[model samples]
Target: MKFTLVIRQGKTQLIGQLKEIPGVLTQGLTIAEVKENIQDALALYLEDMREDDAEDSNAIIAQEEVEFA
Candidate 1:
């Protein structure tokens, strides 16, 4: 499954967060590294969501579209 990922670079590391998955985030040493880390984090987060008793596990994930004005 593909999801929108937002990445940011810190002084000594790279960070990433999933736009579709709330509270799912991770950090790594490089952009590529952060991408992989975020992917793993997102998988774990989704698994946790599924394991939990929360409803709407099949809810659709949202994505943001960019537009120039």
Candidate 2:
């Protein structure tokens, strides 16, 4: 998948994040490094999301009784 990165040139490093995904950010010494880091960060982000989804599925109540008093 291709993601747009919003890159910023900082004083000592390059900072970037996926434009569509929040919390997926990273920094590097150069633009190239920043791009690579962004890929890694995005992958980790997706992995975390998958894990979270799995956890949520596990917590689902298969059967529930609605009692109204």
Candidate 3:
């Protein structure tokens, strides 16, 4: 249920996207707004996927760390 959110300022607005989910993006006038918008979008996307019985290959979130010698 957790996904990486990438936020950036566009020419005239704040843009956001879910790095884990391809093609899932949103934009707003502010960072907070963008975050909220992306959250809503993600929720709707997941809802639709569930309604359609679509399988999510990347449902689980994971992280890895590396050590330098």
Worst 10 residues of 2 by lDDT: 60-69
> For model 1, how does the per-residue alpha-carbon lDDT over 4-37 read when each residue is reduced to its tens digit?
8888877778878888775899999888888889
Per residue, candidate 3 scores C-alpha lDDT tens digits across 1-69 of 467899988999988999989678999998889888998898898788666653553654653555545
Give the TM-score (vs. native) of candidate 1.
0.65
RMSD of each: 7.9, 9.9, 8.3
So what's the TM-score on candidate 3? 0.65
Point out where model 3 deviates above 4 Å.
54-69
Pairs in clash, predicted candidate 1 = none
**What would the per-residue lDDT of candidate 2 be over residues 1-69, giving only the tens digit for each residue?**
457899998888889988889699999998899999998998899899878877799676674546554
Instruction: Judge candidate 3 at residue 46 and give its lDDT.
Output: 72
Error of 3 at 5 (Å): 0.8
Worst 10 residues of 3 by lDDT: 54-63
Q: Model 1: residues >4 Å from true position, as ranges?
A: 54-69
